[model samples]
Target: MLSQPLSKVLGKKTADELIRQGLLTVGDLLHLLPRRYDTWGELTELAQLVEGEHATVQAQVLRSTSRRTRGGRPAALMEATVTDGASTMDIVLFGGAGLMSHYAKQLAPGTTVLLSGKVGLRRGRRQLASPRFQVLDDLSEDEREALLARPLPIYPGTDALPSWKLAIAMRTVVDQLGDEDVPEPLPAEVRAAHRLVDALTAWRWIHCPQDEEQWRAARRRLRYEEAFVLQAALARRRVEHESTHAAVAWSLPGPQSLRADLDAALPFRLTAGQVRVGEEIATALDSTVPMQRLLQGDVGSGKTLVALRAMLQVVGAGGQAALLAPTEVLAAQHRASLEHLLGPLARGGMLDGAVRATRVHLLTGSTPAPRRREVLAALAGGEPSILVGTHALLNESVQLPFLGLVVVDEQHRFGVAQRDALRERGGVTDPQALPGSQERRTPHLLVMTATPIPRTIAMTVFGDLDTAVLDETPGGRSPVATHLVPWEREPWVEGIWRRAAREVATGGRVYVVCPRIDVTDEELTDLAHGSLGVGADEPDTAGLEDLVSALGEDPSPARPLAAVTEWAERLAAEPALEGVGVGTLTGRMSPAEKTAAMEDFASGRTPVLVATTVVEVGVDVPGATMMVILDADRFGLSQLHQLRGRVGRGDRPSLCVAVAGCEVGSPAYHRLKAFAETLDGFALAEADLELRSEGNVLGAAQSGRRSDLDLLRVTRDARVIEQARGEVQAVIARDPGLEHHPDLAAAITERLDEESQAYLERA
Candidate 1:
């Protein structure tokens, strides 16, 4: 299907060789684009070199050759220099081996050219190392000089295809088409209002702009296209999910009576925000549409109270509620705390009197196979008024009878697809005519998170969900003081501990956290040696199993701080962690195991349990008052904030010490240090977006997924993303589907096709 048509055109590789890299479609060929184009327009005057700073010099080859100096690495060194006549500079080219055929070696030099490269001193002789060089052609020196005055366009490259070659190919492709088939995606009025241009024109100007205006117009169009496509896809996915999921009819008995019952039973009064959110949830229940709301707050901001109140409304409506947490630890914690709050619920209603009205049951992986099966059976039989679990609740075999509401805690921890998956199974939207059809009705949802996200980011990530933020932490709770120590600062950390000892003397407890469990056997040995007193070997969440087993076996009065990082194995090993009552809690633990661990930690039976950064988001442990972060430099500021949040949860005072060392000046160190200073979520969020990219919005370094447009920084692109969201919604409202609009469909298809391909590859 492919042939060397280009060989006659450029005398380079024929079409046959190109096909080997999956280059078959015309679209693929165009996307080959360019890495960068050269402008021989401006030649740098060599006299301006500062001797120390690396500089970019653009000159032509006056002369060149290949040679390796006495002790230097091998190279094709081209010595070429250009002059402004007033000042002449020396230029030596190194590592030009890869450019042998690019006339770096073929000329007697004097070939007027553009040489853009990093200028450094080689043996005090100024040299340019492996920078881009282009043989000046077609234009006079003045014209070339004019071209060099502007920024250049760069594109993608592959192992075999050099960037320059890619640029040349792109120039060839654009030559044939010549920006003739540009498509306008927006309507005329919308385009006029937004100052948008056509995509093809943008692509052309991005490669070979007529001027700055053309270049900027092109960029705006392309960036908007990117933002529009992603927003539209997200919108489409959300709409599809919302339409497909089941919705429970919320016919709660009476909020006035429910409030009275809660007031009589609840130990503390609801905050203003909590009361307002309850009204919203109550209002949502009365509507035909399913409630999809996010309840956000920092640690101990009373999100659980709001959620429980909403659940009580669900039960009052004669329907069940389901709560799903990322980890069983969080799930069990939710169940226990919820049960406590709900204990004083109304008696004549579902949560009270005769038959244990609204029955509550926990369904987790560790619920014991037989018992687990029974829990599934109970849920099927509608035995539980509220069902709580990890992912097990999403199991196809697990059925929810009249599940009216769904609460997902820490929603950011889940992928959009996974959350939609749960909503699809448990939540259904019934048809217009039928109210309850056993087929379609989405459960009202209240998504809860303690991460304290900035409002801007929340809008960007959860544009579809209603948001309720609780900024005020409960009164009387002490703010934990944070400290950053370079691993070598043992004395300083000890001083903090000396202070903490006094706090401990008053019946307070301490929690030491780590980044990971032992990922290696060496880490295990180090743990055994207890060498982490100064700087922890980056905490591995893996060795948690071994550490738990070891802690249970080696119970000693010497180990005062129960490490929370090693809990995976602690529960897997024995029923009790420290004879003093220690246990582990984590994402991997089944709901039952987490329930047990949380109980142990909360009750002060297991004063310390080893765990991962999962504790970065608060899981109520009132008794714990002290926290030690091992390998403190390994955590981000946001994470450090969350980890410190675990403490200072109760009426007791709390303290946090970041034990540093290993990998000083690491990103984690910078993050933790910042965490030590700020209690503001918005500030940390801005810093996070600045210091991180999409891959690290949560964690993991992203290599492949970053988009090509650098102008669309999420930090700066907020306005554009918001505009796109609004425009897409308006357009969809007007057109329903873009079936009649070929241009919009093409743009959307390109995005979905790419996203689908990515999903397939990941799968």
Candidate 2:
């Protein structure tokens, strides 16, 4: 049943609907397990039911009615009044007339049924809307007993095919299975060691379990399988990468290299974490193979210093280094930062014609034509230099004749192919070098991300690359005090402006962030859901409890939205912020306007700058020590952490005020509280993983590729991923090309997309 097409089992119309929902194959359907289970073993009286809890109730129908909805949308509502023991409740359903008529039959007066759904208040009266129902008259004694003994699975479905329809299809598929053996990809020894049930049993228990333990066991087995396949693929990629040779491995420095000079010229002492990561990169650059490393650090963790140390080595060895930034703002920031850190060492002493004025150049899409032409000519001339740019570096016209090192900041923003294209430029100087030949001396690659990643995710997604972490911040960095402000409280709402005024009076600047750049709420929903990493891939159908459990609070729907343009205008006119310049910055603004706004805020001319997420990464204004985030609940954990890091760089203590109008019990509420309680990015990152799956962090969400995770969660399955990683390493060691395990190799290939396969080969 798991191997045949769905069209053969379900009708063509149903199959097409499932296909539209991304269920392309029979295996796809099998992997669509329920998000949660519902127990129907016992029935509760209407008076015993608690608000917000889902429960099954047995009651006699007292009244029934069906009527068309007010709007002319061809929809109707079916309602029934039921009484259990002492209290009564209303049952409501929303659908077409056909569905309402169908429910009207089961809800006849004096009918006895078991109804299950969330208990809520509708117009001050208890009600259960769109619940699962079973008519007692149609069930036999044994059938009723079995139904009461087992838990029902609840799946995410649409109106055309509800949860009941999916359950019926699943039952038909299970019945058709009969005694045939299902395909099991894992080896027998592995399954036996883990004490997991066989594939066939796992599938049955996952969809139709008699007890909680059975479904839990089934999930473990499936999760292990998913982790195993992913680790094996990563292992193969690592093996292939290590076996290749590089064309231009730069020589290591002796005692008096420019890298040592740059390190000694730092204005402040290096942190322990920075020194450690810098050494790791230096060692990799000295190796014969082109280095492929990931440099991860929290915001304000001195990642730039480590990258600069690596770039200096390339320049000292008579080669050019290129740094790719995600945005033009960051590219300009990097260029200014490197020039400031380089002191006067970037002058013509290290390499010929490398004057400090010409050594560090910025080349973005907005560069003037004259400057762009001059920069292009200098790059083609083979001068030892450091060029920082955005996507413009990937253009075919730009060339680095002696490129030796490529550093990418916020690597997830650019696809793997774009990074490879820059590295490929290093080898293109020699026209005779073949595309995939070892004679092509590709540049050593170092990718950096300020997004603190959980260890499990780093291993699973970037297993092929060497990892170095910078977790410690340098001395003199003040800790930013965080506070969560509920907009429902009038005092807190009014105090937001007062806080900004006080900060400005102290000669410090502030940052005000909004979810949307424009005045409209057109993308507000997308902004909220996107922050949670739920969109085209993972849909959000979670209930109040799911939200509460993940967010650590109940949700409210009365939260107000913050728009950048509107907030900027409001703050500028506010009497509290008197004589304080308030400026608006957004992606829609011109580059010159953005630069001027940033300059005004940096120079203390503008005490307040209201913007969107454009300033989320690498916009360093140490003088700004106060940040106010409006609609703070709309952001995810990692994003919130990054925004808070914007302050606390100066000698004075900093403060971050998160203003939210979100409901009290919502996931957003919980997330904000959790963020306010801790400043550790790593801890917040782990929580982010549980709240939001590792989709965005893994970069698969951006690539439009299948994450290939059926049941495995990187946050909870760390031990399993480690175990699979070890086993796959041993297997790959014994069979380098996987000749002895063709099935395993084929499975890995099937799991990886073409882009990933190419990325692995290029790296």
Candidate 3:
């Protein structure tokens, strides 16, 4: 009954509106929680109004009028004169010829209403502009007081139905559905241990909390439920996935094997951590059960090398492997890195493909049609090979005949669906039936992430996969010294360019990163849409480098950021940087141009590369020791760390200069300061989680909403999430199919719908 269409529960018109806004079923409405609660029990008088202060006031409408906008647009303005017993104020509501038309008639003379909005002064006349009002018609003072006593839920509104209307509809739904009608998903024993109430009670308190504490407790209960259901589903997936049959059984041979040959051919010795991680992956490859593991290492911790070893394990078993990168640049980089590491084995040595031998192929959007067809043909054949590319690899037309292993670089950048696509490359659904079937088997999965995930996040967001951390940095890598340079200090600002010039003079390169590619209002609109939970198009590139910074709206809402073009132009004309060659790179740059700019910077043709955060990942220039990030407050904590990591790759001592425009003592200022003080990515990741929460951690590619886990915060509610996960595992262990816990099964099914469950399987 709860799964019935909204049209069956609500009216067709209301259902249409809800469905248009992506709220379809009755359950969706229950989860369409209030963004906040407005406590209007304490009302201010008209005389007490302060400019820019949000307030609620009880006033009587003396008169009302509607007029066209001054510019003579189709829009109109609805105005009203209202007064409390103490003083009078104006209510200006901007509208169309029909804007707030319904309200105009209702706001007739002598009508009493409750008005709430930011107080403003228009030509010295105190007014409430576009205030939200509630009619108090036919209501006694006692009734009005009683209505105000309950916290008013402010929901996320849509064009068809305002927040107030949503609140009304939800109240109706809650009233119709009795507390007993909504069964408790969690077992009574579990709920008692966690001190949680029933789901129905939680919904009631959430939608109609009598007080702040009530709403908080209600939210807590819902958060636990969401985390528990998701964790339970993931735990079951892990169990099933680890028990599945492998398509290719690959046991690492002795000292004379190709794996040994490849390892020996590498120029540098593997770190102890790398050797340990490699052994773990090798063991998983040897198992009949397919591998689903995460390899997390700091920037340049040899993740590619570890991934290559796993890919070779599949190759040794006469199966192909595909590596998925988030961007074309990163994909191309991976292809090049693999080819370099594999040395002669990639071409004709041991794991070679001289015609029928093992081969390595590169596939990307930029690859010519003929070359793409060639790569596709090679993958379709039975010969063992390694294919590397971006989302192009996930295209339905691309076929991997005997693909037994999959490696995803910057796995977090891709959505769960894309990973699933890659993992299902061999075209076999049931790996368990591999013993009888001639069909190719499922691939062993190895996902690599350069961004360090917090422990709490790793447990919940990627709880399904086994994790391996590459904690040690390779030898000869210099530590990057970070410093916070306030923009207000002119001398310090001038010194940055001088320092860049000095670095260039010393034969070292410099990366000068700006917040914006160009100064435009499009950024504002993009940001506005993103903040409203609308899907915003991301920067189209490979390796999902600096996406948060590229898609990032301003961290400091009150201030604008400096643009890359303007900064590059200024630097070109600066006397201090006259001798230094400066080149600019941004998302707006053509693929060819970006490549050329990177080449120039790398080869010392342009010693000073003034670019955007596009250089945040996978652009290795060991010679570039100095990085200056302008308007640094515009970036998040992890982003700052990534930008800093771009430098400090070589033996020379490196320095990162972060220029922050934020006012001292501000949150942005303190955040930048904290980033400048710490080089530890893991610590900074924890801090980042606290500051921004995990936005779109799981559904980043599938959805536009920044953070999908609205009610639960991974950082603050780690204990709750962990406890829920444990309890869920225990429950699922006793009843794998959840037959014994029908309520939990139903709830998990509802919460983790088919689409969501499919995505989580990829995770």
Q: What local distance difference test score does each model get?
A: 0.58, 0.75, 0.74
| Candidate number with greatest lDDT | 2
lDDT of 1 at 388: 80
> Please, what are the lDDT tens digits per residue for candidate 3 over residues 29-134?
9889999988765799778778999999999999998877768554787899998877999998875677557668889889999888888999999988888888
| lDDT sort, best first | 2, 3, 1
The sequence of per-residue lDDT tens digits that candidate 1 reaches over residues 1-763 is 0122444434346344455666654455655544444443444567776665455554444655555455656445555555544554556554445654344454345555566666677676666665665556667878766666654656565545656565666566556553435555666666677888766676677776655677678778777877776566556655655555436666554635453466567667777877777787778877766677777777677877777777767765556678877655556567777767666342334434633345567776556788887767766665436788766677787776567778887665455455556666543342122323456566676777655333325344525566777877667688777666655565675565455445545666656575444443243343332211111111223213223322333233232332334533443344222234445544444445656766676666666656655565536767778877775554445456667877887787677878765344655445565677776665676666555544322112221134333345576777888888888777776665676566776665654555453432221
Worst 10 residues of 2 by lDDT: 537-546
- Global lDDT of model 1: 0.58
Q: Give residue 496's error in model 1 in angstroms.
A: 3.3
The worst-scoring run of ten residues by lDDT in candidate 1 lies at: 531-540
lDDT score for residue 576 of model 2: 94
